[model samples]
Target: MTWTIRPPRAEDHDMLAEIYLSVRRQTFVWVDPGKFHHEDFAAHTNGETILVCEHADGRLAGFLSLWPEDDFIHMLYIRPEFQGLGAGTALLQALPEWPQHKYRLKCLVNNRRAKAFYLSHGFVVTGNGASPEGDYEELSFCPV
Candidate 1:
């Protein structure tokens, strides 16, 4: 399915938060499973450059939040139904500065699927760190 990737607007706030929370509930089942707060997701996305993915039918498919100045990807959440459909790649490619920026992200050690996706998209495992739930692998990708 084709998807349009674009910068987020104020009206997309609630939808973005919902997507964030939903994807979290689906992907991070090991982290406080079955619990998600939109308020917390909203706060976490504040001040980040967020881009939303819209399906051809106009439904919001996914979103990615990035801190451009820091070259970090804070979140990249695609609806469970939309996974493996290229929305994640589209969102990552939509990063403002392209290959010029050295982008980094963290994937929980238990999220093997996410780690594989990141690696397949050119991200490399750089390090690891402990978190309240467990250990997370730090990954970085230089777009070029």
Candidate 2:
């Protein structure tokens, strides 16, 4: 399916919130949906740059939430259904234009599938980080 990946607009908060909620409902989703109340979604959107993937009909098929690091992909996600359709790669391809070096992100050890996806994308395990919940191993990726 054809798609357009674009920076999220102010009006996209409701849609973005839906994506966030969907991920939280996923079996591997470690994030708590309660923390992303609609009232604060816009604020979170500001802290984490949002990119929405729009299908040919203009529906938001997925999104990538990037946390900049020295200007790189700190974190990201695509709707589970659209995971293998190049949406993640499209988001990664758009990051370097701002002039960044290495990108780093953490994944819950239980999310084996996601970890594999990162590995396939050229990210390597570098170290580990921990939240109150548990350990989140960090994976680093350099633009190829």
Scored by CA lDDT, what does every candidate get?
Answer: 0.86, 0.69
lDDT of 2 by residue, 1-144 (tens): 577889887777687777766654573456664554555455655677767787777777767777764443544657777778887777766665622457777877777877888899788998987864357788887656
* Model 2 spans > 4 angstroms off: 29-40, 72-74, 98-100
TM-scores for candidates 1 onward, in order: 0.92, 0.78
**lDDT, model 1:** 0.86
Best by lDDT: 1
Worst 10 contiguous positions by lDDT, candidate 2: 33-42
Give one clash count per candidate, in the order shown: 0, 0
The per-residue C-alpha lDDT of model 2 at residue 123 equals 84
CA shift of 51, model 1, Å: 0.7
| Native RMSD of candidate 2 (Å) | 3.0
